[model samples]
Target: LMDVARLNGPPEAWHLGFMLGPRINAGGRIGRADLGVRLLLESDVSEAARIAAELDRLNSERRIIEQHAEAQAEAEALASLGLEDKGAVIVTASEGWHPGVVGLVASRLKEKFARPAFAIALEPGGIGTGSGRSIPGVDLGKAVRHAVEQGLLIKGGGHAMAAGVTLRKERLAEFRAYLESALAADVAEARHVNEILIDGAISARAATPELVATLNRAGPFGSGNPEPIVALPSHQLVDADEVGQAHLKLRFKSGDGATVNAIAFRSVGQKLGNALVQHRGQVLHVAGTLTVDRYQGVERVQLRVLDVAVPDHGPAMIR
Candidate 1:
């Protein structure tokens, strides 16, 4: 797998999560549940390679399935909330949606809508299995448990960030209502102060693989300890192209002729992606974490874009 990805150095946390983890999790998502474990336990290098290849294929298939489900769910959410998007929580369901990918759909909805979101797969028997993802400050698991206790769900439980539930198809409306009412204030507060806390500002010329590696020494950033978000203020968007399902691949150039590659994953058709495409060739303030990208034995710094904005006056300052 490393050879296929052209990874010649030690794998970083991003690679583990974005590259290898998804492939391993894909087996459980849409293929044999034990496939990942088998590959890990296999002592023979050739056999492990075969399993890894299969896992990679499964991950590709999962992405296709997830993309379709996400599109449908996003449409449903839009219809529910209208142009105002006034809802605090988003809930969407469809009869043919794959159960395995519903969680992924939920996650996409959460990110795009900036709200807790659920995607349910309705079975022919009138039972719906669903997954949900939540924004910070919303205790989704607690809300789901409350719903279960109130007889809105057949079964449900999860942590704060993600959860799963099963309910009668007839109860989806009640479930949605319960979550909205239960979480509205928390969601409102979270959104009211939803600010990207950038660590610092830098130019495209200053962002380098060594700098990213040094920043990474903060060690294994995640939920509580987030990776630093650095801003590229007043950078011209030289290129923006859709790539690999819904991701936006981009190039940004600083005033000094330095350029950096960036990608906004799963942003297509969302506000961010739309803004980027519409404003191509214009200067914008971009904020995201820097990472070292290895391709074909070459190392380069790439930004995993998180947010962007247009300057009100001249080039926007990070402060």
Candidate 2:
């Protein structure tokens, strides 16, 4: 269904995977694997709609669960590993955390701590089902599989970006030690590598639906293939506010009076979100991906903010 939609949908619509993938994945997280499959296979329109609606509800529920689990897991991880000082990986486990949501929690940890991370859901009999997420240079799957071969894990496997594990509680310490020893070098290298590549710099007036469509022709973008990151240099921040739990929404204006809307998802309470909320009217160099958002049957370009930096004090020009 998504493949067909990507093939025929408008360039902007091709990115609908972001909108639909999470809803489908929610079924698995909430213990309803069959729901995602059913939605894809259903031939009846009414049945499909019903399944879609149910999935949407599950996705919402998953978000609430994820938020709670992530908070707890992050605190545990940081306390256990002094992540703020120097930590390469965070491996945290607790009884009663949902197995389906552990991967999502681990991903959040990876982003927050800037390192590979694991979130384990310990079950009865000291056995655990764990999921881990990693930064670009860390091979989490290989590390997990290696532990399995070394008899540290009962069973586990994954790719470079993410992985899963099954193990007894007795081996938890040994497993943690093993991962730190194996991945420390890679994690250190990844952390030190900071290369920011921008596709182009455009003014607020140039950000339009036409530009978004043109830039998206080379992409049905998601995951490994992301949309472009461009800079809006020296734009004045007009207004900033928190919305939808932890997202930062902003209004920006250019010197010539052009304005644009932007958002930074899951950034509330983080550095970027706090800075945006506090620094109204500041001129900053904003970096973000261009996306088109549609509402009330109207489409407009929106910048999905990635980062912000103080503008250079020299003459104003696109860097």
Model 2 C-alpha lDDT per residue in residues 195-311, reported as the tens digit of each score: 446899999999999999999997987546757889998899997876545676687899999998887777887777877776778898888888776644677788878877777
lDDT (10s digit) by residue, model 1, range 113-181: 889999999999999999999987888999999898999999999978899999999999899898889
- Candidate 2 Cα outliers beyond 4 Å, as residue runs: 1-28, 33-68, 220-226, 312-319
> Highest lDDT, which number?
1
Residue pairs of candidate 1 with colliding backbone atoms = none
Clashes of 1: 0
Shift in Å, residue 182, candidate 1: 1.3
List per-candidate RMSD values in Å.
4.9, 5.6
- In terms of lDDT, the poorest run of 10 residues in model 1 is 2-11
What does the lDDT come to for candidate 2? Answer: 0.82
